[model samples]
Target: MALNARLEIRQGQGLVVTPQLQQAIKLLQLSNVELEAFVEAELERNPLLQRDDPEPAETAEAPEAPAASSDELEFSDTSTAKADEAMDAEGDDRFADDPCAGGPPLTDWSRAGSGKATDLDDDAYDRALRRELTLSEHLTLQASQAGFTAAEAGIAQVLIDGLDEGGYLRLDFDETAERLGCSPELIETVLLKCQGFEPCGVFARSVGECLAIQLKDRNRLDPAMQALIDNLELLARRDLSALKRVCGVDDEDLRDMIAELKALTPRPGAAFGGEPAQTVIPDVHVRADPLGGWRVELNSDTLPRLLVDRRYHAQVQAGSRSDADKVFVADCLSQAAWLVKSLDQRAKTILKVASEIVRQQDAFLAFGVEFLRPLNLKTVADAIGMHESTVSRVTSNKYISTPRGVFELKFFFTAAIASADGGAAHSAEAVRHRIKQMVEGEGRDGDVLSDDRIVELLKEAGIDIARRTVAKYREALRIPSSVERKRMLKAG
Candidate 1:
């Protein structure tokens, strides 16, 4: 075969994801909180992008006598005159250059504070004032204070990053040494130092071990307690007698020791002195009335109204020097416009999806959990004319605030079980709730209903559930067996 390079022409159609297209798609899928972050990022990157400043106080003037009609008012005071001026000002340069002229701004309604504009310098100042010490930052501070060699500091950094989110040193000593190009002894030495750093018990290997290190720091690790921790599985399984025998303690002493053990925080790494609580700002607020039914409202107060400044955009287009700068500005402006459009579409889609969910699950709103019907991704997808995956993406990690309580979007969708009255399928969650109610209302003196009895009760109510299925549901709900319940009642 002759070796040669040749070009051949062929026609094919395919989709390619350019940066602008990708941004639009991403913006569409973003929940209100995520959209806020994206807009913040764009504001940092593009000088033309800004949170819509409150309409410049409209220059208060004395009001004239009311016009006979809007048509009789001064042309300058009307919106039509302003539109004509905008059209004449841009001329050919309007749509050819600026895409943000007629679009709404990107906004988010999932943040908890009043949406206000702060300058770039203010952002910097805020960051400087409230800097957080990440796991790496804390380690670096410790290493600097300890006065380690440059090589040792580098090795320490690698180990610090290797620590898991829970701040445990999960890497084996040898593996860490190989990656750091140091001996295992050096790695262990650095790990020991890391364990003593701020927050007290970081760089530990396991939860039990983490607690042990903190306890050792405070001189509180008793031999029996340490033994119990080493065999945590036995303790967790309620093998109380076995634990007592192993620790050689009396029942009262064992109980007291167990209580003390419970007080210890196994994940000591989480004790980062003063982290603020995460406040959840709901995207949608829904209320149900006694007779009037449900009403859905978007929390507009949390939304960030962002827009491309038309005034500044014209200045950039008219005063450009380099081709690169022009292209950059155009690209950024396009992105800003697309972001605005995507945001509008996103809001509409979220509202539509929420409305459909409320309509389908109105029974849950009126009555309680027992009235909840079985709903799934396919049903929602079919109703909304969207793919099941799209529905899944919309529901995942997003929450809906409703009359009952704050619930994840997926909470509305449950597997179906045969109903008690044999009318239709009921939600598994609803069935589980009914099982819980029956268990809760059981006679105290008489034998508490076993799984079989519960199944019979469900059958009488018109729900056709098997005994094993009832047992599984009961177990899932954390309800104890009949024997355990009887013992619990006696103890009560």
Candidate 2:
């Protein structure tokens, strides 16, 4: 039989991702710093959006709203508009009533004494507070002040350029001399002069040379000290007897020399010219409430308070003469409204997910990592009446600060490992922590615990992990094997 195509009516439902929905999804996964940058860009593009200032006085004095159920917390157009209106009014006041407002006028250093002295003082202070000079810049400054001849200065500059971050000269003097059209002896002389610069070890060709230079600067470069410095491998192995024979020193003198060597810097130039460390800012904070329960709240410092200026939108809409301009204004109003609603929804979702995580991991929080229970995304998602994907999005790149410390939200979730006695499963993280504790408590004088021994110990403790699994966890904790640890102990 031949089939004929015909139009038929059918009823179906599907989800569609609009541009605004995509933006809201993106906001859910962004870190605190990234969210701030995104909101700043949106504020620049949409003139109707503005940032709300943080006011502690008003927040403290205002009556708290009644607690709402989770169902009532879902995103709604009416509630979102009311919230935006309240935020807009709160931000419009340039000078709100303050108990500490009736004070004397503060001093304005910008207007002090014709401003010339103030400018000079400010410049000098700023320069002092700025970053210190880099390694290359320090060397160059010292070379300029050393009173070198023109040709000798050129040679010194070449040697400085050839130096590595450890302040070691990695190039051969003969090769440098050939490249610069000079003799090796002249190059060596210039190198010696450059080595006299600050930091005590700028142009050393090896580790021994670096330490020797520092010892010479301190007038402690005796024959015994030089011999001790030459055999660093024996020192690393902690062979005090070999060092005594090589340096011809007794136990007391060897101990003193070892202490002196330990005080020296290995990489002199490492203290300069690297990116500054970044500080982690948490999105949520957990603290104990006076009512005898944990209080989980979004960090106001990290949370962005944004509002749509409805008054501005109304004025622009009233002034529009053409249909296209009116449509443009209406589109802007719609976009601004959607953005505010999305932000509010995002905050509520994050708070809900984080609160549930804190509730499930309460044992871990109250005790320690050893007490952390097994948890997964579905467990949290089902408890909160949301999809697993939504829970994943909420945890990604977000951080929470608790009494313990700041940790990523994803740190609370761990894979489950079956128990030996058919009881509740154990958390992988807890098992790893237990393994680490056991290894740390092992006796140094006795035999080290092998992977097989560890597996047996874990089984005795009601954990059913394999020997290979024990080894994997040990490696993850950066602990060496039994043989390696035994070797290290013997050497020490």
Candidate 3:
């Protein structure tokens, strides 16, 4: 019974994630941008690793790049079978060719990730082709030509510096006056001059001020219109009667004023250059197959074409300069080979997971959002013969372009809401979409759907969701409560 030590032999299976295994695991979860950075770092660290980019002549000879699309998996079944067969062999066996290598499939597609739809907007193409002058640059140039007295010009520079990205002068005149060692009256005078520079509403201190400036430019800043701008909050609340009373205008005139107000820019500086919007490089592209089903493939432009330089390895090996040098060379060879294999494996795993998701959500792709089936990571994991955790990693930060639009892989794996009739469960996303449709299509006569009422509608549609669940979904959608909505829809 007492603790005792004895020589014994025992064996048990355990997961020991080696450095190589860790690399594969890390590669699975990284988004395209992160993966590229990781590959670039590895290239720098390992001399034997090289980028197998396409030659310029080969690229030029290639046909014009197709629109953002899904290939029918040029990585053939036979090639995959061959890869699987050789995977267990030594890493040295497959250094000759990169299994993931191909044409720059995304060529023009990566730079323009908004997809082919952007092509329809010639303005978008034009904007992309030209480097724009920023709000700061445009204002500074105008100030130089704006022709002000020395003191007024100095005050204008201070005012311009205080302007926000919306081109609104957010500076407190008194605080700015103190900072610039000038009188607040002089600051106001300079600001008035700066306001007339360009874009019409440049030096506005408030939304009402911004709009009033624009109206002044168009010779429409009548007293009633000015009153309407001042009471924009009432207009936003849809209190048409209140707006008409406050502005001293009839219903017809108020409606016209509101329409004119809508046409003015709320954010005048947003049109000018700011920090560029980041474009998502999708990991997978799903497109309609000519014959029938959905075609899914990896966005190969995102996949780094990597190869192990066996020639370099052989050259390094033949020298046999020292034991340390031999070890370093051998280690580099191992690392380079493992990286190539890991990348190939990562690509295959992504395609497998994506294809299974497309299969499960086939109804959604063919029809619309309402047809999206209840899905979870476990469902995809089991179908693809992988673990739930593995599927989660594959979906992390990964995006897919479908016929509908570019959606994150995680978007397809919505929680399930039980069915009222005990039929197939409904996807939470689909239910949320349904709730949104109901709210948006509500009659202008002022009938707003309450949470309880929404619950009833969902149940009628075969969703067994509770009133609390309905409220939660509504809140998540940012739809106001029935009381709030009724007030919003109040006419008088």
Candidate 4:
């Protein structure tokens, strides 16, 4: 082999993902809330960017509506002239020398990716003021009044911080003592005192310890109760005879102890302040059209309306005295324009993907879950002339509100189960739903359907599913085994 350096002029196709293009591709996967936050951050960072909330007078004066979209289900006010102008951002000689003027890598919904932008992650929204004191806060207050020395109070704080989300202290005594440079005996003494704090089970190392602390606080942790706690595994398995022998109690006494155990709190931390629950907003709305098919529309409220303030850009550009200042203004304008264009493209892509989904699952939307045909990303991507990756990104974190119900976009793409008759394949989601219906409908006839029986029933309905697959689906649905159900029914 000869080692040589040669410049061979080989020209071929290649994908070059620029900084701006990368952000646009990322936008496709972001949920509505995330997209809103991303746009808001961009607006704040780029001085040339502004919200697209048109003034009332401007709206009235510009009543000569932009062309309506061919699909009734497209994004509302999508083709506003102002938005288009913002995207252009003085497309003149200034951008001729620009490095990032070329557009994005994904399929163009419009003339997007025509400029460059960067990405940012920021706090999108403010959570409402919640409950006053958190778990740590409450514990700190309790520790201050517990009459502990300063060193012991410090240890208590460390113990409080060490608690898991379920209020269990997962730290080992040896580890805590080593880290704090304290004696294991002192650590144990402090732990015993902290365990006596309010919300009795906060510093326990295990479920049994948590229950024991609660029982001890209630003055019910007798020797028999301690024995019962020691053998909680037998209680969980419902081996009442073994538990009675271990606790040395009669059946009635055992039942009473078990009932008392059930009354204690397992997770003391969960009752304290935590992150507020965030509400999911659907990105697409699907409803029946008056004349015929489904009409799909974007959730306009969640969509961020962005615009590039070219006038502000021009003002800043004119005021620039140095080369650095001019370059900064130009870059800001480019970034702002790219963000607006990316958002517009994002909305269009979401609408297109969502519309195709509605069309494919028409039967499902019209009827119910049983009618949902087996669908895949490739099917929708091929139908819409997009890549499978693009479809996947569009579906990620995206949701649709249909007349039937609100569902995530990815919910429509279920694995296919082979059909018994060699006809159309069955959707795994549909099969799971059928199983649930079958389970709920049973016991009315004084019978419980076992996994094997469910598989047979499904096969009779033209679905060729295995027994183990049926069992897996049953377990996923949290449905207990047939034997357990039979015992439960008898007890009922």
Q: In TM-score terms, which candidate is top?
A: 4
lDDT of each: 0.61, 0.68, 0.69, 0.70
Which of the two candidates, 2 or 3, achieves a greater TM-score against the reference?
3
lDDT of 3: 0.69
All candidates' TM-scores? Answer: 0.49, 0.50, 0.51, 0.53
Cα error, residue 292 of model 2, in Å, equals 2.0
Model 3 per-residue lDDT tens digits across residues 233-323: 8988999999899899998998799899999998787788754434767888888889999888778788877777777678879997977
Which order, best to worst by lDDT?
A: 4, 3, 2, 1
Task: Report the poorest 10 consecutive residues by lDDT, candidate 2.
Answer: 93-102
> Which is superior by TM-score, 1 or 4?
4
Ranking the candidates on TM-score from highest down gives: 4, 3, 2, 1
Better of 2 and 4 by lDDT: 4
* Candidate 4 lDDT tens digits, 1-492: 999998889887433334554465667677787777777677767777777656532321111221122274333322223322433454422111111223333233233332333545523322313445767668878875564443465567668767776788977888666555568888898899889888879899999999999998889999999999999999989999999998999999999999998888889888878553356688888878889888877887877776666666667889999886876676776666666666666777778888888888887666554355678998987787655666787898787887744667876765778998888997665677688889988779989999989988988999999999988878766689999999999999
| Candidate 4: residue 281 lDDT (0-100) | 82
Point out where model 3 deviates above 4 Å: 1-13, 53-276, 429-461, 466-492
- TM-score, predicted candidate 1 vs. hidden true structure: 0.49
Q: Worst ten-residue run, lDDT, model 3?
A: 58-67
Better of 1 and 3 by lDDT: 3
